[model samples]
Target: MASLVLTDGSQLTSDSQHLGMYSSPTASLVLTDSSQLTSDSQHLGMYSSPVASLVLTDGSQLTSDSQHLGIYSSPVASLVLTDISQLTYDSQHLADWCPLGKDTYFRKFEIYSMAWQNEINLDNVVLAAASYGGPVAVVRDRKRFIKVQTTGKPVISIYTASGRQMSSIVWTGGQIIHLGWSSTEDLLCVQNDGCVLAYDMFGTYLHTFGMGQEAKDTNIIEAKIFASVNGTGVVVLTSSYRFFLVNNVKEPKVRQLAEVAGLTVPPSSWCVISEDRHTRVLMARGSDLYLLKHSEQHAFPVGLDLRENTKSVVEMAVSHNNRHVALFTDLGHLWIGSADMRKKYCEFDTKCPSRPRQLVWCGTEAVVGHWDTVLLVVNRQGEFINYSYDSPVHLLPEMDGVRVLSAFTHEMIQKVPLVVQQIFRINSTEPGSYLLEASKQFQKRSHRSDEYIRLVKDQLNVAVRQCIDAAGYEFDPSNQMMLIRAAQFGKSFVPDIDSEPYVKMCRTLRVLNAGNNHTENLTCGAWCGLVKFGNFWYN
Candidate 1:
């Protein structure tokens, strides 16, 4: 019953009763026995060993071995696959949409008399850009004007939401020099010659003041007429050095606030009040920055001196948010600082690599256009995003893509996307030259697509002949998408076929092959054949 037989090699009887103790060579395999080997490692391709166990390189057993990497990823951060049919605007600089919501905020437009270039007279430059409520008034050349420049010229043009030129005003007299809009009554102030003209946005003449004054010893270089705090149709005047609270004595319908003087100290280049509607702080410019509070019908000056640098402020504007202030110096330095005007945040040397000019913050972003090309956006933290386009143009926001509103004077209107406006918004920080150059580069790249079409012409005959066969030439998967787009658009997509990349793409598409080998699914099939060579494509 327990017979044992051991010859030169190895043998076994089918029914040996004592076979349990008759041991043979012990296999080194650990995971599964030889009989279960197929089940244990069936996932392995082309197994070379007589016996082996499955173990992942990470020391863990893989549940499944079937996995292929996804085909697309974000061009920059994440992949956004847009359905080809849903493309819009063929935007050259299509960035992600800004997350800012729809809230009504004030946008200020400054009208500049760019007399440095072609000497366009200040009066002829229609300054009708800031009329959000009605045709805002403008002071330029020798006249205090209202609503100018419709189709052209020194005429004030009014605009409506329905793309209608609602109203306009034309003045044939005195050169206007300064203008301000009162948010309270929607009134406009036009200071020209030696008088100030006040009017409603509808070209309704309300009142006039300071008429025919003597031009001797009066250092009123810049002036703004604000509305009374009580809003009983009264006016308050502010100048470079003092505040004059005045009302229309002729109309008898005016009220006067407190006219305070001796508020501003000397050696100050520029001064402005805190833009806060309540608790407004009076700011004075001297060798140092000081805060002033208006109370008890008097200008009370505070003794806080914030001395940051020696550069003088030639031009300055506070943000509507009252968070930050921008300063431009005669040296062509664009400096940003806190709303308190205490500390300097950062400074950009905008002096033309040739000559320096002025800096103006047109509400949302800062622009330095007179000297060279520089557009800047300064955030509260003092960081900047700058985009520089190669032209001296003013930027205006085109809200609905239909109506173009000017920032200054709110007068001049254009149809096309204003290059000066949007391009400057893009240049918040120096995008280096590459991003700036890319806008132009896109056009060249689009033209080069034509070359791709011509190169594929020869390959197309063969590809259509065999709609299912493998592509003949060496295939590159990177051009797979380009080939697909080319096939879809055909000759229209690419007019030039002389480029090498196009030739390579055509060869990869198997456009040269004949017979039913070239299939509509040619991209997939071609990618599969090229996968052996480590090139892959995804639709």
Candidate 2:
């Protein structure tokens, strides 16, 4: 038998059967094992914790843990329920961990990781990344060998910043010579015949375009798809050693670039930087480099004072902004300077001829290049911050840092931001650093904490913002929590500063840490997803 119940006009029956269902005339009610509910869906609060607490729909919770401590919802999710017996880090602890260099502009640091050792064979992978902390795209490098050997079409996959698999697509179209991403996250697939196809993350074709009749007839030997303020752009190199350009993928405005004399071999490497007025392409030959500014089908040859034995360029990279350019030569020399070469920062040599597999700019502050598993993060000056990986590595450019991807783990190498340095560097003496120390001591009920607070009372607001910005740059979750808590503690003495920034940092870090958890649990294999995003302009 079955029985029905109502709200306020209901009969409470004990034994109608286990299959009984209940309903109210004016409200929609649901029943669980041990809890009762009301019809007001707008104020819903439900949970299954052993402590019998409730979590509201809007993410507020009234749990015993917080009530016992007499504190409201924490600004930080990770620090809310933490035990007091555990100590995360001292205010000065991070200074010893971050490395300092001769680059007076800023300090560089090797970020510790919440990374996982991957099972993928990254040596054969060609990688790309979306700008502003986007996903990484991994494709099998078909040009690594002289002979094309494969059982079937290669696999292209995408993964998040934390290495969680997003999607995998089998390459069933024409041979995939190169894979990149558009500003809006579409994967641009460039083929040998100058055909450019756009696909979503799952590899479903959206649109296609050609690189003009010249590229189709001569067949493209190499091509580069870069970012533009308007949209995605493309550049193609034909077997006949000529260059073709498309300003945007959406409009497909193809233009042929001027030839640089009787050159036959593909120039070592080249990059594009899109500007407000026009796009400029920078190409480097053995010992010479040329800047191709469209509008006058003429390539301007630029002279340089590269070091004696460091000519014969092999690889080159330009920063996300068109402000800086980097060049690598056969003599193991790296030239980093303003795009015009007017302000030469440094010309350091690696002293090896193996040629770096990749050279990329890290947030305009440094250049990151890698060979096999060895990566060197050289600031605009000569400070080299080297990181050794357990397996093959790939560098992905981001707005804040460079994402180092590998079969073993995914990591980030970036400059220790100025605000963070002020708060954590050894002997900083910055008010924010003093505030952090004060917060730690105050938690211990020491009078010394009051003295430290008085030192930074005038600049309490600035101290809070510095800690917030530094927390944004941190790679570790625990470190993020500690710094934020210190900021929260420091702000308590001052009321003029807003809490919104700290609140936002807490939520963003929480989301990032949650993503890290997913990355840690990734099982199966690397062929699951392909991810990459970048912005490009000709320089």
Top candidate, metric lDDT: 2
Give TM-scores for every candidate, taking all chains together and pairing residue i with residue i.
0.40, 0.74
RMSD of each: 24.2, 18.4
Q: Any idea how many clashes model 1 has?
A: 61
lDDT per residue (tens digit) for residues 374-478 in model 2: 878788767776767766777777655666666655555556567765665434567777676677666767676787778788988987887777777665566
Candidate closest to the true structure, highest TM-score: 2
The 0-to-1 C-alpha lDDT of every candidate, in the order given, reads 0.34, 0.64
Ten contiguous residues with the weakest lDDT in model 2: 523-532
Cα misplacement distance, residue 3 of candidate 2 (Å): 76
Candidate 1 residue 447 C-alpha distance from true site, Å: 38
